[model samples]
Target: MTTGTSKAGMMMELSHDSTLRELTTDQGVLRYHEAGDGQPLLMLHGSGPGVTGWRNFRGNLARFSEHFRCLVLEFPGFGVSDPADGHPMATATDAVGRFLDGLGLHQVDVIGNSMGGFVGTRFALDNPDRVRRLVTIGGMGRNFYSPGPGEGINLLMEFTENPTRERLVQWLYSMVYDPAMVTEELIEERWAQATEPDTLAAARRMYGKAAFAATAAAAARSEEAPLWAMLHGLRAKTLITWGRDDRVSPVDMSIVPMRTIPDVELHLFPNCGHWVMIEQKAAWESTVLAFLTRKDAA
Candidate 1:
């Protein structure tokens, strides 16, 4: 890792070399951020225009790193990491396996946000012995009371298709219950990354109208069961967190996992939105840290 500095709000006092690392796996060149040392804690980021592992979990790294070796895996197809062929979600799920194999980490504790939560759950189901514990922040399970493709998702698709500053702003605002959380610096940073031609193209592959139709069609043809149906098979002790006011992948979407996962706990933050970790940083970090450190019955 090369030492560097930048004004990205997420970087804060974090120097590049101390955190950023890369591994060349068969899947691709995987980029990640590592800090401290202990039992591995692999953090996965959500799928969004300009979303990176750093931006998604940087706030909680300092706290998490103190007790664990924090590895924030930047999934492929995101601009911060190498882009891959095929649907971004499938690429991300595959990247997790290669990332662990390349690093020689047999098991880890995982904290996943939104789409990351979905990916983590899939991984834990597929490799039960490899995940010691799991923490998910929104975007797991199927839609319950809320409408499918919630408000924030619509805004995200709009931004992906148009690539306009205005649309990005709209989508950013919808991510949190408090609009104040979407600052000019955040917008500027996200806009610069999100509009990159390659990044925009990747986003289109995941959120564009054509991509949505393709995803639905592919799902209809596949024989594999949905994540909700597979939750009961997960062996990891799980903590599911959600913002009561989330517009994208609303709180209702957490219902299935909360009920079906055999070893699970659910915590809902009032007045919070999709970005629960950011919108309720202190409380969330506290909650997760406690759960991760708790002793499991023999």
Candidate 2:
């Protein structure tokens, strides 16, 4: 385990036993974390500037690992993953698909959050036979309104300065309805990761990409979007989890898809925000376990 004070003097606590492996994809070396065993379950993180598999799935890893082979991937340009040559979002789905293939995983359950959710959905559409089931938490890739200046400005500021403990607490508070759930340790850990030299630069690069903004803008313009179309075509049993209080993606986005997809099931977590898995781990884990188990039995 690497332990030291980061550039911002925050004490970092990384997993000493967490093995890092690389998958040589056409894009580059894609780094990922793996734990436990059983049916394979690939976890994809959100689209935050500094988001990685650790940031999104840290809290629920153990619970899911008990039931499945959990593999968490750091998307290109995030965490330890190498950057892709083209647009970030455009290449992400392909990179992820190749990573799965490298694992010799022909079909696996995919659980994605936010941007990861969007990418996973697209991956399923493009390679339906490779995915056994799907779960999306506060996913994007729809024609929703863009973030306003307030949201954009805050994101820009986070790219420059290391997010203070207070700032992280505030961010989570805004994300979850119950502010009390924002623990001191949670805030500290996130602050530590966000301030790391490698992570900070990766975050800056993501934020600096004009392609990311353009892709998001373009995604917000059409009703019959790729994600929506993909949702309609998904053959795998699907679960859509949303934070009732999520301001980022909003729970309303799940309405149309839930109604349209016959195999899709939707769950709304009250008092939760964008990071539902982190904020409501117990409920989230139970829901996922039950769903995956039932599907396997069938």
Instruction: Give the alpha-carbon lDDT of every model.
Output: 0.87, 0.71
* Cα lDDT of model 1 by residue, 189-248, tens digit: 898888888878888889998898889898889899877988999999999999999889
Q: Give candidate 1 regions above 4 Å deviation.
A: 1-13
Residue lDDT tens for model 2, 185-274: 766666676677666665554454453466557777967555665566778789999888776676667776787666889999987888
In the predicted model 1, the residue pairs found to clash are none
Alpha carbon lDDT of residue 175, candidate 2?
61
TM-score of each: 0.94, 0.78
Please list all clashing residue pairs in model 2, or write none if there are none: none
> What's the residue-level lDDT of 25 in candidate 1?
76
